[model samples]
Target chain A: MKKVGIVTGGTTKFTKTDISIESLLVSAIKQIFDNSSNLSQKDVDVVLTSTNANNKYLANITSELSGMAPKIAHSVESLCNSGTNCIVSAYAYISSGLADVALVAGAEKTDSPGLVLDWDKSRGQYKHPIYWSSMFTSAHKRKFGTTLEDLAYVGANNHRNALDTPYAYFEKPFSVEEIMESKPLTENLRLLDCSMPCNGSAAILLASENVIKNFCEQPIWMTGIGQKAISASFTKNDDLTSMKSTILSASDAYKMSKKAAEDIDAAELHDAFSICEIIELEDLGLVPKGEGGSYVRRLYDTKDRKINPRGGLIGTGHPLGATGIAQTIEICQQLQGKAGKRQIDGAKTGLIHNMSAAATSSTVLILES
Target chain B: MNKFEQELRNGNFVCGECSKCNKLVWPPSDLCNNCFNNVKWRPISKIAKLVEFSSKNDEYFCIAEFENQIRVMGKVENILNLHVGQTLTLVKCGFDGKEIFVFGLGD
Candidate 1:
């Protein structure tokens, strides 16, 4: 198989503003054309749109709006991780020589139907994500003695980091005390611990090694990709203290990339909720098991930008389908030395973790400059 | 509604057990996940062990496992010093656009 690389990417500001999904996707795609010096509609051989919206023929619609007619066009829907799923499809097309250049765009509306997994009857009346997150929190606390303060630090740090992220939904940071006092969604979860569903879109241009330099002066290589789905039902996740899918996917990603967690200079974790970050830190091998709380405490205490530098889902706003693509864009920018204030100094490699439906499924990507 | 919903609607918690492999199919599917064989429906045990729980506005909800395989989230009643691995009896269950499972500890 041939090599694939990310040539350029663009994202619209995440907000609660009402916008058409088609328009949101086009807005982000337009940025790719505006930013890339030599990229044109004709150069794109594949167009894949990712969103939870019920709209039909979205990829074709996006391509028409963006003035592109590609050999391959379709949509990818896997709930929260749809963005990366779309990018992965594009990577497959480029690497397999089916296509040399691919355009991947993802977007979501604030009221997108992807928020709830209604089909998972195992969830019963507790279908909303918070219920599942609460269970995870309760178990993690029981297993690791993770305090509410540790959860609060995850929120506080991400919100603080968002202040420097221009496209993030939150403009202000909340103190740890304030986050602790934020409206209680459950006994173990607070309103601030959850990510806000908002309107946003992100687009990325992928090309084979042969043509990547034509679109980007500094290309970020997609070295490794890993994805796993344990089950669609949330209850099938037997281990609440950790995301099993994340662990398995991260292991595969590390093996494929020939790199360990230590090689990840910067990372964008799937902090859909506060406890999620703590668990993901441990499950991804970034920190020792049962030590995620302390590791995050250290990151917060030292104001480190190594994790979720783009503010993660909690502070950046989660637009579901757009989330994974946006996360990949953050790491790309980090590796490209263009993340500005959120940049980790001298970052040469980065990781992006995205999951769907209560961590029942996950996708991990390892990228290098 | 499918067989699962219909059963819950009638206040009977039934699950599909594979006829070929004797595997219990959860979330109530007609086809067994293990062997792809037809399944027979049977009432699940009312007694369940608590997996985990949390409260919303003083109202507790929890995950309950039955037969060591089936698990579902439901509202907990008669909560008196509840803890994980503790057993609770399913007092009531139903379906009204949403599956509802109610577990109780005491009369």
Candidate 2:
């Protein structure tokens, strides 16, 4: 694959703001230009928007708002992983020689529709994600003897990490005791165990290797990329404890990058739920199967592994469409040594894992400084 | 209502059996997920084993595995000292005018 690099990136605060999706996209786009040295809106060759908002012409609308007239413009939607999907699409456009520079922006409102669990009729009243997440938690506990304390550590650790992240929604760190005693949203999931929905936007400027010379001085190269989709309904999946999509997508990415799990110095995983981060850790090969709880406990005890240095979705707030893009930007900042107080020292390689809809689809990207 | 919901309304638990691979398909699909062949609906045994379960607002919801490797999600009634891998049997189908399958502890 042709080498593509992220020239510049930007993100809005992940909070419950009353900003329209259009304004949010424009803000994120302007931030990218403001951060870059020589990049301009007119230099863009393609513009892609990742959103679930009702706006149909988001691609065109973003261009008009940002004052850009790109050759290609469109929107990409795949639930929470929409942001990563847009980046992957932009990567393709740059690699295929179809475009020299691509701008991928993702924005979502807190009240965006279509997030409800009404697609499956068999679920009836039990269609909500809380039920599915509860099932995963119970199954993991039954299989691995994972306790509630282990899950609480994940929530607390991510929350603490978010204290230093400027764009994080929940900056107040909660102790493990507080997380365990928080209000229960489901059988085993507490209020702190779930990622809150909020309004946010993220933008990334991808440039081909040739364009990087003139556009960016220090670009973060996107080394490997992989994506996969599985069954949307939870019942169709074979194992309730692990997501097959993550496993397969991570494998593809590892093969492309010629790097193993141990080679990655930092990672930004989708922690839509506390258990999700643990399960993704195992499925992505960062930790052995059935050892995710222990791994998280170690991170909590020592603060060594730089997982979710930007506080993950739990601490950063899950803005659905913008989440994957925000995660990618976090990894980029980590690799660039620009992550302020949360920076993981000597971080050269990083990974981003984003998934959607009960882990039915996923995208994995490997980035190197 | 769909065929699966209609079947539940008539007090029958039916699943699509792949005509080619004989794999049981859940969520009532038109084509076999494994072989991409046509599917034929057939009645399945009411007996199932509890795979996993959780409670919310004192109501228990569970995933149960039946014959032909078919797994279904529904509400469980008469929730006693329930545990994973316990035997469960379909007690009734549809609740509150919706196709909500209900199961109970099996003897």
Weakest 10 consecutive residues of candidate 2 chain A by summed lDDT: A114-123
Candidate 2: Cα lDDT at B106: 95
Q: Using lDDT as the measure, which candidate wins? A: 1
- DockQ, each predicted model: 0.88, 0.55
- The TM-score of candidate 1 is 0.99
- Measured by DockQ, the strongest candidate is 1
lDDT of 2 at A260: 91
| iRMS, model 2 (angstroms) | 1.8
Q: What is the lDDT of residue A3 in candidate 2?
A: 84
Q: Write the per-residue lDDT of candidate 1 for residues A284-348, one digit (tens) a residue.
A: 99999999999888999999989999899999999999999999999999999999988899999
lDDT of 1 at A254: 93
Backbone clashes per model, in order?
0, 0
Taken over the whole model, the C-alpha lDDT of each candidate is 0.94, 0.87
RMSD of every candidate to native, in Å, equals 1.0, 2.1
Clashing pairs in 1: none
